[model samples]
Target: MTFRIGSGYDVHALVHDVSRKLILGGVTVPFDKVLRGHSDADVLVHSVCDAILGAAGLGDIGRHFPDSDPLYKDISSLILLKRCANILNEAGYAIENIDTTVFAQAPKLEPYKDEMSHKIASTIEISPESVNVKATTTEGLGFEGRGEGIAAHAVVLIRKISKKSG
Candidate 1:
């Protein structure tokens, strides 16, 4: 079997909406504003999805699921992640591990890191130990530090299926 590594990065602007929900790692977060996007705007999950797709040598999420498509309007990112997993399976690849980092200046995220890792692992059908989630501040150096948006980066490793599995 062979191994491949891929990395992905994503960012979304934060918008004001008292009622909009902040969903990350499939967990709801209490916040004053939520990300603005055609989908549910889970930056973390989106990056992870892209990493898996890249590792499998597939095109990006935009090519596979365009925001212009009405079917994906307001869709949850978890659903998108699941579809990416299916694509990997069809390509005879399985996730070996994933590492992710989120950038945000406000609303300390350390408390939720573990749950985030678990959610990502469950979506990819990998063990929690195979996934790592971290949060950091840009030290007021970028848009993320300015609190204009949230960004996520993910690196993933995938293993090709053996001949027997194929």
Candidate 2:
């Protein structure tokens, strides 16, 4: 019954690129600007990955999947999330629940919250009820409010299910 908790935050600049799509929590949102990053740059998913890894005593996402790696270039963040899930399972940690928040200035995200939660939960092999996704605006107070970038924060609760075997 060992319980651990971790929190993570991530931000990425927004850029106008017709070739790039705005992806958040594994769901593509209709927006004129896309997040700029080496991978798909889904800030929400990245935050969740970091939270899960931290809770499991694993390193952050950058340590697991570096932006310098060609294999991750333009790769889907969902794949990275699945890998994090596998890492947690291998370490005998079971996810209890995850809560996340996204900050943005435009392209209202209310319509896509459910899909985001479901997709993230599915990727982690957990129930959708265990994952919660929320979005908010900075009220013109920061980079997100200025529409310059998007940021996300995530918190995860996990418990040790079994001891790792040597």
Candidate 3:
């Protein structure tokens, strides 16, 4: 059996756009501000996608979903995650585990961790237990602490499945 590990991190600036809701891990969290980006800006999902792609040696998210593309405008990161899973499947890789951390200063995320895990697991077609999502604050230390942006980090482990001897 072969295993690969990949780590990813992403951050998006917070904007005062009430029209745009704050989305993380495919769940909308109640917040006054939202992250600004080309896509829906679900930071957690973006990081997770990057981690999965990295594990498969497929480069980063930008390589697959370039921001320059008009088709991905305002696209959902969850969709990107699903596409990533398909990419992994094509490469004969299966998700073993995914661990992630979200950084923010407001709108406490503790309540949404479980849902995030389940959503990610569902998207990847893996057991919910294989996904773990954690939230933390910077203690007023960095951009996330200053409430200027939201960030997430993800580390994923993937296993190459063996083909049956027909």
Q: Which candidate tops TM-score?
A: 2
Query: What are the per-residue Cα lDDT tens digits for candidate 3 across 1-166?
Result: 8999989899999999977899999999989999999999999999999999999898989999999999898998999999998888888888999999999988699999999999999988999999999999999989999999999999999999855232
lDDT of 3 at 39: 96
Residues 20-104, candidate 1: write the lDDT tens digits.
6877776677788788888898999999889999997898889899999999988989889999988888888889999999999
Query: lDDT, candidate 3, residue 159?
Result: 91
Per-residue lDDT of model 2, residues 4-113, tens digit only: 99898999999999999999999999998999999999999999999999998899999999999999999999999999999998999999999999999887999999
Off by over 4 Å in 2: none
Each prediction's RMSD to truth: 1.9, 0.6, 2.3
Give each model's whole-structure lDDT.
0.87, 0.96, 0.93
Candidate with more favorable, higher TM-score: 1 or 2: 2
User: How many angstroms is residue 85 displaced in model 1 relative to the true structure, after the best TM-score fit?
Assistant: 0.8
Candidate 3 runs further than 4 Å off: 162-166
Error of 2 at 5 (Å): 0.3
Clashing pairs in model 2, backbone N/Cα/C closer than 3 A: none
